[model samples]
Target: MNSLVLVLVAIVFFIVAYSTYGSWLCKKWGIDPKRPTPAHTRTDGVDYVPAKAPVLLGHHFSSIAGAGPIVGPIAAAVFGWLPVMLWIIIGSIFFGGVHDMGALFASIRHDGKSIGEVIHVNMGDTGKKLFSWFAWLSLLLVIAAFTSICAATFVKVPSAATSSLLFILLAIIFGFLVYRRGAGLGISSVIGVALLFFCIWLGLEFPLHLSYNTWVVILLAYIAVASVTPVWILLQPRDYLNSFLLYAMLLGGVLGVLIKHPKIQLPAVTSFNLGNYKLLFPILFVTVACGAISGFHSLVGSGTTSKQLDNEKDVKVIGYGSMLIEGVLATLAIITAAYIGQDKLAELLKGSATNVFSNGLGEFMTGFGLPFATGKSFVALAISAFALTSLDTATRLGRFIFQEMFDKRKSADEVSSNPLTNKYVATIITVVLGGLLTFKGWRTIWPVFGSANQLLAALALLSLAVFLKRQGKEYRMASIPTVFMFLVTLFALVLLIIGKMSNFGKNWPIILIAVVLFVLAIILMITGVKALSDNKVSEDKNFKA
Candidate 1:
């Protein structure tokens, strides 16, 4: 077997081990699935009720598994596959997994409030405010990124864009039927997958021609509605459908590599050079988040997900398992593109890696009884649909974090607490901002998000480390990985900032944005020092049902 096949096999084994062992640990922790979640316990029932396990996982995965995982790994593959591969495995196992699991466990134990709430309660008001800024900014970057990626893909592939529109409509129809209509998950999932494939077929048979502006309008409208809808309605159903697409892409991508048997073969390691922008450890870390550790995981873990825990024991699966799936996805992407030839990858996938991914997957799926044209088109549209779904979720999450950041400056009525209102305003603001900024033809803006995201990763990891420290028994055991990842991420982000600053110079729109973030990152890091010495803290609950 080639290196790609071996790497894939190893990833599969690790995922199984982690999920199974993590589940076992949950039972060992005495987590109970029977008790009401904090959302339900604290709910007036309009919203904030605890979710079913699958539903919660769907929300979490959809929110966190955005273009980051797809884009980060692919872009960082420039640093050669070894470092990316190493980080993906080690980070998921020790760093990212731990960060995600820790945030989740902490939030659940505290109540289904956000990480911001937990920060205030345990780390103090100052810590909460600073971390909240990091959280909101991190999510905003997500909105800009995934939105741009989707917009670009829609513009490039009109047929796929139309297919995506159909699939999303189908997702909503089934979402309402299965979730809102009390139809079973199994039935809904099956039907949802079927509809997606049919849309793919339809796209091939009769391509729709949507202009770039027209598609953007459609994308924005879909996001506005989907963001506020209940998890069961749009988020869960669509994500469930998207998950199958992702899996098919994964399977097909792997098969393509196997059939092609190409290799990166670009030498075991490449030198760290980006001209005068020396890419030391910092650049490596910041530019390569999802493959390694991402701060964004904390938001999702603490956001809608913690409310839906079937049992405290399931964190490993939802948190760690979802990340593992992403890692596998990234690895497959690496093999597919690298094996195909890097120059061709840069040519074909340039600015539209999702298209190349879907294209490759389409070719692979064609052998599985799917028509060639239909499969290729299906592959493109499936990714676009997923990206659009993530754009909506990320916007809502950003809005939630933004509004929740500061102390109440006004009465509750004065504040916009309605998710619908918040989502609409947030999406418009971000899309408008993103559209305006990139309209100047900027690739620099793209990496600003990467830097900001890595900084967020540092903050979330620090919080996770703090949580572990407070757990007396677990503290000692967790300290090593916590400290190691903390330092590595910190170093990586610093490099990202330096690179951005150097790359953009004084007129650097994105560099200025990133520098501000780096300062905030430092302040938050200082806040951690205070958290360490300030022994007076809230009661950290046992995360059992």
Candidate 2:
């Protein structure tokens, strides 16, 4: 298979999906351009300020497009490129896009509330409380895993570490210029991009050398500040700036594929079992978690993006459209892995997916007339940017979860009103806990993180199904995906539990965490099922009336 053909096919499929099915979903969901979003109505300057569609899209895409999309496809490529590509295309259109759009719609309808609050509206208080804690823990796992991953990158690759630090500084300056000085977007963006490239050059020349442990502490400290700062101050602008680098890499890779027309050297289908591992049904589903459907996107949709949404009509674009873009990135990742060859991929697979992606992406960039070392450094910086965006976003979302959990019994006006459970307190607690979890190592946290992420997506889909049912709208769109993800993720959890129990003494901590996640998932599923049943009964009664 020619990589160019794969790239073209994926691009056409995504465009068709976005134009037809995405538009259909928007219409069916009744998107109203005239509707005032929370950003307009709530306008708190802190969390609910309206943003232009492009800017919000940048933040939303960058935050959600973390290493997961890159890593999942690369890791799951062992099942062969065909399986990975098929899942990315079909799943993005049907599952991931719908899940993300529904989440955003639910949150906006509820005045920028987190999905946990959405659960409360549809599934009752008990369900809300359970889901809230589940979401918080899932976010903590995200923060921990991403922080460790970024820290490791910084420790191992001094250029990436230096570039990332400079990126943060540049974000703050960019934010100040744009938000405070009222600078023009075009001018500020050009300057920001120029400075970023300079930093990349500087980082290569003067790299930062830090131990892994030190890097972890510094990264967590950065998260602490970034998560608590006003969205416009750091989070939004930083993501917007980082997004340029991401887009460049995506475009560069696509063009590289087109120019080089690399032959796909990897097999199209391998054994369902790889060594001691099985690449069959549920494992492939879980292994390819993010590229197809990620629960974390829901967190981002409801937790942060909803608050900044300027128009109801933009939800389809930001939520559904961004997901399709990720699907494309995932496809590119599959191509990168395939081009790396099975032998080298097997070796790289032993380490972080960042290694595989950077190396392969370096080769791709070389086709564009760049030195492999420089291209590798650039790719490494982009990966670091991706991880950092996800890190702070997860932290911010975790804060929202904590505040909601603490404020459960209160009225909407009083929620998070108490200083004790305020944003600052909640953020600090969330970051500290996540920092502790980071010490457990990314290798230890990733499996559970991936499973928990997919499980959360299942739960979010169920919440959306119930929301649609209450609206007297067609809900099979959400419900069917909900059921599928639920089963797949539940099966994955069971397998993890069995594996963990078998190594109980050596992995007791992880085993305990896995058990808790399993229990929570089972409870949440039961709650969702009951909610659907109750909604049906109510609809029947109303029909009789």
Clashes of each: 2, 0
What TM-score would each prediction reach against the true structure? 0.87, 0.96
Clash pairs, candidate 2, are: none
TM-score of candidate 1 to 2 decimals: 0.87
Ten contiguous residues minimizing lDDT sum, candidate 1? 435-444
Residue by residue across 1-545, what tens digits does model 2's lDDT show?
A: 89999989999999999999999888777778888888988898889988888889999999999888988888888888998899899999999999999999889988898999888877889999999888998998899999998998887689998888888889989988888899999989899999989999999999999899999999888888887889998888889989999999999888778788889989998767764435467778777878989999999999999999999889989999999999988988899899767898989877678888888888888888989999888888898899899999999899888877877455656544466478889988999989988998887888788889999999999999988887777789999998998888888778777777766887787777778888988998998998897745232221111
Off by over 4 Å in 1: 1-4, 16-35, 43-49, 211-214, 258-260, 278-280, 349-351, 362-375, 406-442, 476-507, 540-545
Considering every candidate listed, which one attains the maximal TM-score? 2
Residue 401's lDDT in candidate 1: 67
